[model samples]
Target chain A: MTNAERKRPGRPPGPSDTRDRILAVARELFARNGIDKTSIRAIAAQADVDPALVHHYFGTKTQLFAAAIHIPIDPMDVIGPLKKVPVEDIGRTLPSLLLPLWDSEAGKGFIATLRSLLAGNDPSLVRSFLQEVIAKEVGSRVDDPPGSGRLRVQFVASQLVGVVMARYILELEPFKSLPVEQIVDTIAPNLQRYLTGELPGLS
Target chain B: MTNAERKRPGRPPGPSDTRDRILAVARELFARNGIDKTSIRAIAAQADVDPALVHHYFGTKTQLFAAAIHIPIDPMDVIGPLKKVPVEDIGRTLPSLLLPLWDSEAGKGFIATLRSLLAGNDPSLVRSFLQEVIAKEVGSRVDDPPGSGRLRVQFVASQLVGVVMARYILELEPFKSLPVEQIVDTIAPNLQRYLTGELPGLS
Candidate 1:
């Protein structure tokens, strides 16, 4: 049978197409109901496919969410550049890699993803992304006193998230109006401190 | 007529009652649609009163928004304690005062109000409150090089907003679980730098 002759008009053309359709449906549901409340079965049901198909395409909910919000520049890709820098210089190198991406056109997707996270509907996803993805990746590279790496990563995340919220989302002026380079300069030292500085009051 | 006889069933009991009713309606509309989109006419109509009455009582839309989100403990009251501390100690004192309030029962109202602000429906209200109230009060006390005090105040606002978002709204771990005192200790120095330290980079 010829390719055109054998094709089903109503069905997605191929497996890749089917996967894309499932992802689109998943994105819509996740955005509306949040990641925690959105179930794979519900996504498959909404996508008009078998639940097994979702399981086949995306092995877990976290992977599915990562796919749904996937930008061209994967977060791993963003973090990859950090690996090249000396551990001590990671603080300075971190902002140079991150700030430009956020300022770029690609950052809009991230901004939206962040807004969804901050909407406080599904905190589990935010926690997972922070602890599992971000902390794991950044912490693995840095040598710290056992559990301190996670704390450092968390502080780093807090500062970065806060900057994004104020500068991009909230559009707080001075921050909003400042040149990107200036912002990088102003914030890099703070990020550095969070990454490696001593906790002044923690026992 | 006796006071009881003079009271009409449909009418508000007193001027203050009518004002309260209007404020309540304004709050609902602002929460639903945001401050910028919600009009005085809409608020008045929702409250079953005249637009002029809204204008008369609130004076302006900004004033009306300020009224709607007003917590029992004013921002001024929160800043009042900072006055007793030396300007150098303001950063430490500021969070010590604010975090306890947020951790208290009264902070619930502030949390709700903050959620409304973060919803991005009416940034003007957030900007006004930050600039006119917070910056003005804090700036008045801090002796900085000309124009830098506002910058300092804004930076302080950004940090506070970010901390509230992570700790309260997003509930990011460690930040969510950390004791208020630890958080104050951790963040106080950063606030101090923003408030008093030479800004590292600016044109």
Candidate 2:
């Protein structure tokens, strides 16, 4: 039957409906408390499902976070490889890993979610991911002058985010059509500088 | 009288109403037809006002476009300076001029308009401004390999746009709070590289 027919009153909530409810609750809690402070049990409780079921469906907290944000892949798929890369090489390695993913079909959902998140009142989810996840994972490694790593990653983030905007959103000609490697190679040095260079006020 | 009373139907349309109608028409035409193709007369005609009145209300087509986009300052205020700067200096010159303006009180409206524009279905107005206005102004100067100038400017746009996203929208700490000079100093070399650097595939 059609989705509308299925949604008529007295019908039991389908698995997809339950999953959507779980996702909605997960998004709310994750956005409010952030990835670090938010717990799987809390999301499960709010969704009225067992914690084990949440894990069974979405695997891990980070994975659930990814799904909540409509990112189809696990966060670790990229992060795991990143952990293996040396700090000095992260500049080049990052776009190399990410560009392909962002260029793929799944990337559309991510770009859409990002546009909506930025457009929405609460950018906390995006901020939380950048701060709690990306900063902690990559920023710690680039922390050459003790406490300057976060800012370094942030500068890198600005450029990377801009690339996303130009290529995907603004869809600037030639830029939108440029081969992925061209972009990666062009921005790599700049990203490297941000990660390891002697930036002003960073000492 | 209260704004509600002032907006009452019995009263004749105020100067503000006429100005707003022109701006709304300008925005619609600019978004659909782009800056180069759209004209003051067309916008004035659409708004049912005299073309001279449109010019009186807004100084020039570019100024009208700027107003349509909610940029409080005239577009020429920034573009006029860049016209004099040597190509080599543009990298440093741009952010030095822009960051302060973005940090100013008037920038709030521009940023809001930008957020809404990106969020909306038609990013055409932004695309038009970037392509027709910015690309024509700066891209022509940087066209070292003949046809590569536009792409170069687009890359620069990506980075600059990213800075706006990071500092203003994402509110990344330290990035958001960094002194304007610090940001300018940091991104200048990178911007210069994009402007004149030997980017891959650009030969």
Q: Against the hidden reference, what TM-scores do the models get?
A: 0.74, 0.93
Q: What share of the true interface contacts does candidate 2 keep?
A: 0.91
Please give the distance, in angstroms, between residue A39's alpha carbon in candidate 1 and its true position after superposition.
15
**Stretch of 10 with least lDDT, candidate 2 chain B:** B113-122
iRMSD (1 decimal) for each model: 2.0, 0.9
lDDT tens digits, residue span A45-130, model 1: 98889999898888777678777876436566666677777787877777778888888898887777666655545555456667
Q: How much lDDT does each candidate structure score?
A: 0.74, 0.91
Candidate 1: what's its TM-score on chain B?
0.70
Q: DockQ score for model 2, please? A: 0.79
Off by over 4 Å in 2: A1-9, B1-9
Q: CAPRI verdict on model 1? A: acceptable
State which candidate has the highest lDDT: 2
Query: B96, model 1: CA deviation in Å?
Result: 0.8
* Residue A164 shift from truth in candidate 1, angstroms: 1.5
Question: How many angstroms is residue A128 displaced in model 1 relative to the true structure, after the best TM-score fit?
Answer: 1.1
